[model samples]
Target: MGVMNELINRENVGMLAKILAEAAPGSHWPHVVAAASELDLLSLRARTDAVSRALLADLRLLPDPGYPTAARAFRSALTAAGFTGWILWPVSEAAVTLALEAGSGADPGKDFDDCLALLAELTPRLTGEFAVRRLLAADLERSLQAIQGWTVHPDEHVRRLASEGTRPYLPWAVRVPGIVLAPEATIPLLDALYRDPSDYVRRSAANHLNDVARHAPALVVATAQRWLSAPDSNTAPVVRHGLRTLIKNAHPGALALLGFVPASIAVNGPRLDRDSLALPGELAFDFEISNTGPADARLAVDYVVHYVKANGTRSAKVFKIGALTLAAGETRSVTKRHAFRQMTTRVHHAGVHALELQINGIRHGHTEFQVRV
Candidate 1:
């Protein structure tokens, strides 16, 4: 994974320098490249942010005295490297972000304008989703106004960024408390694009609503119901995705909105292949399920393994097995394998662990197993 990111290393920096040297021969390309190459890329936690920050620091070393000068030099290099279209997405993203990071300490009004210009030039190919958040954090009203304008932009990417950038639960970015405290701030933006013709834009709007759903479940459910109620709606996919977390957690209102109410279920023979197991072993289990209802049933089957933590307490981790549609008198058998191997994300402790069968988020049957380290 890290090897693929070699595009952000010394070699790529040299390539970018060569382009800048051509675009503006007077700029100190050699000095900039050397300074940037010396940055401790291995020390930075994330690849994109690290490479961007390195470029920003190196641009600062240029003889240019102000943010405008540095930004112009970098933008010139970007144009020289054929960054206008979606030719090199990752490269364009890193370079454009360098422009934003370069102006972090400059005047707020100027920096905001610069970021908007850069996003217009490079977005869709290289998302300004993460970069726009800085402005949101700095000037709430001004940034919100700018993003509202973006919702109707002709560019699909810019329109998507309008919703994506404001997402309260956007991964790899800090949470926006403003959206959490007053989700109404995002309603207009989401509403504007709910029926957007572009899938890209609609997906972001749905995801933004989903994030709000975590903090305001009732609001999201109501919004989804309203959208679903529209005479002609294109929001089904979006609403389904937005309600995913809620559906998995079996929120009553959410399930009712999605028409996925729990059904009566029974589990049989849910026993491990072996009651005892050692480290680096595979634990296998099989089960039988039957729907003894008068009508067909829709079931979301899952398993919960109560892993014994280091402190001797057990923590339950739910793993999805399968979903089933069973007739009134239908029966089915299900089998699954759980690997008990070493993993970076989990540590196994020796103990008897409790495992249960969950049908539509309701616990049905329990089994026990012993694991030795």
Candidate 2:
């Protein structure tokens, strides 16, 4: 597989140079091309920032060397279909950087506001999600006030950007400290967006809420509850996705909201197919559950694998085992085959491991097994 940094390489950088050159007839953008040579040692984000600096340098030469001039040039490029795809990553970055730099001038607020507008315009070409972070960090309330209007924006990408750009832990994006410090600040944006007609927008809204759930579980649950109370057809899925982290952690409120309420059920052996296994192998297991309660019960069945880390201390990771509904006195069996392969995200360590069952947010049986790496 190609590495991520390769996404912004020589060919694409030249494409960007050609685009910018076309956008501004008299201006040269050799600097944008020069940036590609410096990208070899940089990570994906670093490459983006480096190219952004080069782009900004080129943009500064546009008759007048400030944000208004650069903003117009960007708009002209958009009109000419000069900006699109991965190339826009650095273009958006340069726009945000210019906007922040301009914010230090006499009319700081206007620069910031204009940058937000530029981002909205650029989002459809490629997300301004990463670029918007600098503005949020610079002046959060001002940025958010502008972004709140985006929840109802005609463009779904812009609407998604409103929730996605302000996410507390948006992946591959910088952390906006103010958003983290004041988690409630962005909830209103999410409130308006969770039921968006566009699934793309709704998914971003759900992921945004999931980011918040990492640190503010109660707040996430409360917001999810409110959405559930006044749901559209897609609300349940949105809430389920938004509450995924909480669900994995087995948060009671989250579980109950999704109808995986606490129930009286009998769990049989999580019965391992083998008590010991070699590395790069598979561990098969099966379990049976019976609803012993007087009423029908819903179950969110999941498995927890307590993997032995490098330090020899086991960290528990939860894996989903699908959901089911059982009539009172009914029984069902579940089988799962878990692979013990080395992953880039997770390294296998040879030691004793344990598998446990979680049904309806409650831990059931534990079965210990040995792993030979």
Please list the residue runs of candidate 2 whose C-alpha ends up more than 4 Å from where it truly belongs after superposition: 61-63, 104-106
**Residue 141 error, candidate 2, Å:** 0.4
Candidate RMSDs in order: 4.2, 1.6
**Model 2: colliding residue pairs:** none
Please report, as a residue range, the 10-residue window in candidate 2 with the lowest summed lDDT.
99-108
- Per-candidate TM-scores read 0.79, 0.95
Candidate 2 C-alpha lDDT tens digits along 1-373? 1488787887888877887677777878878889978888887788888998998887776678888877877888886564687778888888787777774656767877998999999999889999899999998988999999999999999999999999999888889989988999999999999989999999999999999998889999999999989988999999989998888899999998899988999999799999999989999999899999999999999999999999999999999888899999999999999999998889999999999998877888888999999
Model 1 lDDT per residue over 1-373, tens place: 3554454455655665566666656655445466345634553224445445545565566676445665565566566644432223333344445444554554646755665666655675567677666667756677788788888889998889889989988986767677788887888888888888898888888888888888898988988898888824667778877876776666778777765677766669687899999999988999998988888888877788999999999998878776688988899999999999778689999999988887776776788999999
- Candidate 1 ranges beyond 4 A from true positions: 4-7, 29-31, 39-64, 82-110, 192-207, 231-234, 279-281
